[model samples]
Target: MLLVKKKGQGVKYGYQFLRMRYIIMADILFEDIFGVKDIDFGGKKFLRVSRIFCESESFKMELLLDVNTQIYPMELGDKFRLKICTTLREDGKPDTGEFNQHDAGPSRADQFEYVMYGQVYRIEGDESSATDTASTLSAYVSFGGLLMRLKGDANNLHGFKVDSNVYLLMKKLAF
Candidate 1:
């Protein structure tokens, strides 16, 4: 159940590589449709900074994120699909793990209105964290100090691991 998409028709890896199989259904590490519940909670403020709290549509996960509103403005009623993935390559190739602003080629980030590159720095479990489900887990990511906390079930956070390079892609949903 981890994402490890490999190319080559009619090919398979050894049992030792089962953890890195072709992820047909789940292309990315984590995905959730989040509805903005509140903005500027506690009046926490800094120049060009706004903290937005959101709740997931399907997994019931909660996200408290700090985004630079100057670059990517979000409204009080904004609903978006937030995705955390290992690679931005549409072909599923892993990222070079280097920062190359002029990297040639089309990326998955092109379709999204907002994107950020970050890493999963921590993960913890809290038995009482989730009210709806029995499972409890949380993944913390930082996009250059703009932090994100995703808390919900462990199954929803399957592929996430510490030090994993990730891309946060967001696209607004129109009703």
Candidate 2:
């Protein structure tokens, strides 16, 4: 349960009343609302690929992601919900890490328009923030060379691990 100050309802004084709201635990490893800050199309170096810079809406995380523009295109100012997960199975079971037909059953991927399977290759703490041991960390993953670097607080990125397989799900937010 998260003790969050209820919005618009407060105590007798000027303080906001603390309200209890339960968070349901699920297979979501990490989720965030991100806005595309800028895009660097690795022109000629990687045709049909764009290196997009994004910043989180709430957590303020920074992301440098390379996407295959030929398959999934993202333009400037595009806001999307990104979720990294361990499985696409609806039952929360571990994925076999194999490309399988989606006809077996309903999947978490069913609700997502874009999905990619990737493996975490690196995770490191920010040496600049050495005073605060777990201040910030970066996780790098690769989906067949399309790379992603997620940098944020260690607490918010606890579930990530080097060599762990993960699925990236994304859906554009309609604003």
Candidate 3:
């Protein structure tokens, strides 16, 4: 875990009221997200996603995707990708903490860079469906660029705006 020493009383006060923040670097692999039921959060309903490269030993986790807001949609399954960094834990378990404010630094491209281009095969739930011969869609996009493209059936064509700063690291590394 990463820690910052307090320099003054204000720092101590902040720690007492605010939570300590940290970031975790690890590999993330998309597995699947098949079952989707409801959207309890007043958005695009809830979906179950299967992940293999998660830092957590549990192996699988679910995220709530707000289809309405394209800014940061929860990992719907193997469909969504991950961008991570590395840090050590006291017990030896991988420290996979959320990227917090204190963790801000240079862009991942500055350290490493790459591009990921793949077809979005499926989008489980009532939202959308997969199309085409491979039943897969092809997309070519740069990790540190502004727009990522998704190509498939004209009916299924779409684009997702990525926050390069947040996903740049994981996008560069191969799964």
* Candidate 2 Cα misplacement greater than 4 A, ranges: 1-26, 41-44, 98-103
The clash tally of candidate 3 reads 5
Report residue 48 deviation for candidate 1 (angstroms).
0.7
lDDT of 2 at 96: 68
lDDT (Cα, 0-100) at 66 in candidate 1: 93
Q: What is the TM-score of each candidate against the true structure?
A: 0.80, 0.80, 0.20
Go through the candidates in order and give each one's C-alpha lDDT: 0.84, 0.83, 0.30
Candidate 1, which segments miss by more than 4 Å at Cα? 1-27, 99-103, 129-133
Please write out the lDDT profile of model 3 over residues 75-119, one tens digit for every residue. Answer: 422233333322223122233445554754443334433322232
Instruction: Give the clash count for model 2.
Output: 0
How well does candidate 2 match the true structure in TM-score terms?
Answer: 0.80
Descending-lDDT candidate ranking: 1, 2, 3
Candidates 2 and 3 compared by TM-score, better number: 2
Position 83, candidate 3: lDDT: 31
| Better lDDT candidate (2, 3) | 2
User: Please, what are the lDDT tens digits per residue for candidate 2 over residues 1-175?
Assistant: 3243456774333222222111113457789999999899444357798899999989999999988889889999999999898888776666665656765688878888889898999999899998976599999999989899999998888989899888999888999
